[model samples]
Target chain A: MKVASIGLGLIGGSFALALQEHVLEVEIWGIDHNQAHIEAALARKIIHHKGSIDDLKNFDLIVLSIPVDAASALLPEILHQAEKECLVIDMGSTKNDVCEAVKNHVKRNQFLALHPIAGTEFSGPKAAFASLFNNAMMIVCEAEKTDENLKKKAYQILQKLKMQLHFMSPKEHDKHLAYVSHLSHVSSFMLGKTVLDLEKNEGEIFNLAGSGFESTVRLAKSNSKTWIAIFKQNKAEVLTSLKEYQQNLKEFEKLLETNQFSELENLLNSTSRIKEILAKK
Target chain B: MKVASIGLGLIGGSFALALQEHVLEVEIWGIDHNQAHIEAALARKIIHHKGSIDDLKNFDLIVLSIPVDAASALLPEILHQAEKECLVIDMGSTKNDVCEAVKNHVKRNQFLALHPIAGTEFSGPKAAFASLFNNAMMIVCEAEKTDENLKKKAYQILQKLKMQLHFMSPKEHDKHLAYVSHLSHVSSFMLGKTVLDLEKNEGEIFNLAGSGFESTVRLAKSNSKTWIAIFKQNKAEVLTSLKEYQQNLKEFEKLLETNQFSELENLLNSTSRIKEILAKK
Candidate 1:
C-alpha cells in the first residue's frame, strides 16, 4: 500500500523506518516543513521519495508525525486537499486540539488520533530507527469518530509495528498524557536545572552521579521546540499536573526541613506502590 | 590481606565479591548483626566465612557497610577492639557525623571515610556483584586525618576495583553528596508519590509510562532502611538541598501558571547542559 509519512522527526522517522522493515509491500512517501529533515531522512533511506500536501491524493494512508501544533493546524487542510479514500492518522502526543479542529469537517471520519508511547531524548530524522514502537502502548483517541474500514487498515499498520493498542476518549488521553508523560518531562527538566545550579561548584560530584541520576534526568535533553508545542497544546492539564507535583514536592520539603523522618519515610512508602504497578506494565 | 567485611548488605557484600574477583591471596570474613543476612551471604559465597565485631583484631582491614546510624555508633567500639595496624573504613553515604564520632579516638589514624558512588534500588546480599565498583567514583573523605601509609593501602584496594578515587574533606563530601546523590533520591521518591496518588484512577496511563518515567522514579523503590538513615545523618544538608529543589519546582510551576512558555523553554535549555557533563562521566 502507498503511504505518506509526514514530519520526519524521531516519531515519524522511526515510524517510517519501522514500516519499511516490517511491511514488504508498503511504500512510504516523506513530507516535512523542515527541508533539512527531509534531506536527512532521504539520505538515511527513511523514506522512498519526497511528497507534498498536493501528493496526499495518491496515497492509501497519510501519517502525521509532526509537532502537535503543526499537526493540529494542518489536519483540516490535509483532509480537505487529500483524496476521499486516503486514511489520515496522527502520531501527535496531544489529541484534544487535533480532534476538535476536525470535529465538524466533512472528512472527519477519515482522521484518527494516536500516540505511540515511545521516544528517545534525541530528535530529528537522524534520530529515527526501526522497532522504536515495538512492544509499546499505542493510545488511540476518539476511535469511534473515525471510519470503521479506515481504522482496520490503520490497525493493520500498527500491528506490523507490534503495538499494544488501547482506546481512550480525546479528553481522557489529554489528561492522562499530561500526568504520566508530560509531567515526567517537566519534573525531570526542572530536576536537571536544580542539579546544574546546585552542583556548579561541586564539579567533583558529577562523577558521583550513578545510573539512577542518568535515568532520572534523561528527559532533560529533549528539545524545547517539540516540548514547547506539547506543553502549549496540553496547557490546562499540564498546569494542573504541575500544581499537584509542586504541592507534593513542597510537602516533602517541609518534612525534610522539620525533621519529620517518620512521616517522610511513610510518604516514600506510599510511592513504592509504583514499582509493582510499573513492573506489571 | 585479611579483610573483615562488616554488614553484608548491598555495598559490603558487593565489596566482598569485588575483592575475591580482583585481589589475589585475600580472605574475606563477613560480619553482620542480622543472622539471616549472615546465612544468606555465606550460602551465596559473598564471604569466605562469618565473623563478628569481636573478630575485628584478626583482620588487616575492616570495612563498615551498615546503616549510617549503625556505622557511626559502632565505629568507636570497633576501633577500640581492633589492632593498631588494621585500617578501618566506613562505606557510608553521610560522612560528617561518622567523622565527628571518631575524630578524637586514639585509633583515628586507622579510620578512613568513603562513599562509593554505586548502588541499585535492590538491596542485600543478592544485590551484590563483582563489578559494582567498576568505573564508579569513590569519594574519600578526611584523608588528611588518616595515616598516610594506611590511606595508600586503601587506595591500592580501590585501584584494584578500577575506581576513580577523589579525596574531599568531610564537609565537602556531605554537602556535595546532598546535592548529587541524596537529593536525586528525594526528587525521585516524591515524583513516584505524586504519580501514584494522581494516576490511581487512570489505570490506562500506566501503559503510557515509557523509559523516562521509569528512570525518574526508579529510586522510589529503594528501601527505606538505608535511605531513612541517609536522610537522618545528612539532615541539615538534605534539608538545604530539598529547599533549593523545591524552589526550582515552584519557579517552574509559576511559569506554567503564568503561561510564560518562552521562559519555561529557556529554563529547560539551561538544564540541557547536564547532558554534556553526564556524557563525559
Candidate 2:
C-alpha cells in the first residue's frame, strides 16, 4: 500500500510509523508545509519519500493530520486530486468544518473524517512514535458518506493499530468533543495561567506544586499553533462549554463563600463519579 | 523507636508503613477514631499495635495525619500528652492553623509542622503504601520552633524515606499552597462538575473524554472530607487564589469571544512555562 502522510507532525508522523509497523508492504510518502518537519520525519525514517499534493492519484491512501483549519481548507482539493480508487482521510481534532468542506465535492465518497483521540503535550515529528495510537479511541465521523471499499480499507488499518472505533455525525462529534476534549484544554491552560501569574510574585511557589497540579496543568503545554486553530474552528461550542464551566465554578465559589459546607461536599461528591467513568475508560 | 500513628488514613497509614520500612527496631501504635481504619491498617501491617492518644507519652514519636481542621483541633492535646523526648509531627496539608493551635502549648517544642507533597486521589488505609513518600517533597514549616533534638530526629526519618525537605514559615507555606495545591483542586473539581453536568443530558458525552479530560479532572475524585477541611483552614488564601483563577478564565474567554486569536495564542504560550517547571520538579 502506498500512503501519503500529510502535515508530518506528531499525529501524522506517528500514523506513518504505525502503518509501517503494522502493514507488511506499506510505503509512506511525507508531505508537510514546514520544511523542518519534513526533514525531521525523513531523518527519523517515518516516511519512505517526500511527496506533494500533485502526486495524490498515485497513492492508495492520503492521511491529513494538520491543524483543523488547514485540514478543512485543503481537504476538498485533496479529495479532488485523488484517484477514484484512492481514499483520503483527515485526522483533525474538529470534524464538522472538514466534513462540510468536502460535503458537496464530486469525490466525497473518497473522504473519511477520523479523530483518533490520542496525543501528548509535545508536538512535531520529534515527539512521534509508533505506539501513540495503541488502545486509543478513534472517532470516525460521517463514515457512511465514504465509499464502502475505502471505509473497509481504513478500518483494516485502524484495527491493525489496535485502535477502538466509534462512529458519529460531524455535528455530534464536535459537540461531544467540545465538552470532553476542547474544554479540558481550556481549563488546563487557565489553571496554568493562574499559577504562572502567581509564581512570578512568589518565586518558589512551584516547589509546593504536587502531582495534582502537574496533572491538572499538563495540557497547558500543548502547541499553541495547533490549539489556536482548533479553538477558532470550534469557537461557538468551546465558548458554550467554557460558559458552563465558569458557571459551575461560580456555584462552587458561592457555596464556599456562604459557608455552606454540606452543599460544598455534595457538589464535590457528585463530580467524584468521574472516577468510575475514567476507570471504565 | 516506639511510634504512635494518629488517624490511620492514607497519610497516617502510609507514614506508619514507611517508618516500619525505614526505621530499625520500630513499633507503630495505630490510633484512629474509625475502628475499620485501624483494623485495615493492622491487617495491612501498616501498624503493629492499636493504641490511644492518652498513651502518647510512651511513644518516642507521634505522627498526626488527619484532615487539617481535625489536626488543628487536636494538636495541642496531642503535644500535651507527648513526653519531652517524643517528637510530635502533624502531616496535614495546611500549616498555619496547626502551628497556631500548638503555639502556646507547654509541649510546643516537641511539635513539628510538616506537609508531605504526595498523595493520590484515593483515600483510606487501603490506599496506603510505604513508597508513597519516596522522592516526594516534604515541606517543614516553622522548624525553628520545634526542639532541636526532635527536629533532627524527624529529619533523619524524612531522609530515610527518600523525601526532599524544604523549610519555610507556616504562613508562607499556607499562602503558597493555596495557589499551587488548593486552587488546582478547585479548578479540577469544577471541570469535573461541568463535564459531569453536561454528561447527564448527553448520556454518551464521556465516551469522547480523552486523557486530557481525565488528567485535568483527576483531583475531582479526592476525598471530600479531607479537602473541605483544607479549604476551610486555608479559606482566605484559597479564596484569593480561586478569584485570580476565575479572573484568568474570564480573560481567556473574552479573548476568544472577541476573536483575538493572537492574544489567545500568546496567553497559551506564556503559560507553557509550566512544562519546564513541572519537568524540573
Best by lDDT: 2
In Å, candidate 2's interface RMSD is 0.9
Instruction: Name model 1 segments beyond 4 Å from true.
Output: A202-204
Q: Where does the lowest 10-residue lDDT sum fall in candidate 2 chain B?
A: B52-61
For each candidate in the order shown, give its overall lDDT on alpha carbons: 0.87, 0.90
Off by over 4 Å in 2: none
- Native contacts present in each candidate (fraction): 0.72, 0.87
Docking quality tier of model 1: medium
Best by the DockQ measure = 2
Flag clash pairs in model 2. Answer: none
DockQ of each: 0.74, 0.86
DockQ (C-alpha) of model 1? Answer: 0.74
Model 1, span A1-281: residue lDDT tens: 89899899999999999988887788889999889998998899998899987667878889998889989999999998768788999998899999999999999999888999899999999999998999898989988998999999889988988999998888988888888888889878887887788767666567667777777888888888889889988989988888887788789778877888889888888887877977786
Candidate 2 docks at the CAPRI level of high
Considering summed lDDT, which 10 consecutive residues are worst modelled in model 2 chain A?
A198-207
